[model samples]
Target: MRIAKEIRDDRTVLSIQEDRIDAHNSGELKNLVLKTLEGGAQNLVIDLARVQFIDSSGLGALLSGYKNANLRSSGFALAGLQPRVRSMFELTRLHRVFDIYPSLQLALSA
Candidate 1:
């Protein structure tokens, strides 16, 4: 669960450096997202370019972050999803629920 954090265009970009987001480290991802939002990040973008795989727990973690962000009237988005990882979101129909971009640059611009 190595996540890199940076600020771009007033948005907090959290880059997942791991290849997979599964049951083992989903909790860490969830906690980090919550903590980042709680720390006053109004715009949050998760960069998942490096993540090639994700399970239900991983999706749940991200959904939790999305819910919390909405509760606070903040922005939450996902960027650079690998094809395989994107398919999971599609299969679950989560792709429609999330603001997804092809690249971090596109997400930041939006």
Candidate 2:
């Protein structure tokens, strides 16, 4: 599967199971996230621990999820970013837009 879904406390975590989140799967990723929110997820967390590569489309999907969560009055966060993936967020300045954590445990606690 490209994604794994789980609920931890009040947060619904969508962990990307792929090595790369790019053009091919971005659309599907976006849809799954929105569906998760519609299914009553109060807090959304995108776990990128296994994703090593991401592109503009992937970033867009994340942003869409963030906006959708905000519209629903739910919180959104990101966790378990690999170093290169973390750098991509940093370079794009998306790090400022999302609450990023080093691990899922930290994100869950927050």
Candidate 3:
């Protein structure tokens, strides 16, 4: 798992330090996100600046995380999407679901 999670200023930041997230580890990725949520950080921001690649399973992880956040009445946001990954979200119409931001600060503000 190349992901690192931290809580700062009452917000959760999950940093994906990997170039790719795929079927082999998406489940673990999802678990990490859930763990962050369960750990009491309600405002979530996923920093995707380093995630140059993502498969369907990775996308599933994001969607599931969003669902979990919604169910818990918390906020979920995405930040620093690479153009390629952003394209995938656009193609899948998921760009509409996630509140994307240019930076972590912006996401936290929203």
Candidate 2 minimal-lDDT segment of 10 residues: 1-10
lDDT accuracy of residue 66 in candidate 3: 96
Model 1 scores what on Cα lDDT? 0.97
Worst 10 residues of 3 by lDDT: 101-110
| TM-score, every prediction | 0.98, 0.96, 0.93
Model 1: residues with Cα > 4 Å off, grouped in runs: none
Ranked candidates, highest lDDT first: 1, 2, 3
- Positional deviation of residue 88's Cα in model 3 after best superposition, in angstroms: 0.6
Q: What is the lDDT of candidate 2?
A: 0.91
lDDT (tens digit, per residue) of candidate 1 on 1-110: 89999998789999999999999999999999999999999999999999999999999999999999999999999999999999999999999999999999899987
Candidate 1 least-lDDT 10 residues: 1-10
Residue 40 lDDT, candidate 3, scale 0-100: 72
Q: In TM-score terms, which candidate is top?
A: 1
How would you encode candidate 2's per-residue C-alpha lDDT over 63-87 as one tens digit per residue? 9999999999998999999998899
All models, RMSD in angstroms: 0.5, 0.9, 1.1
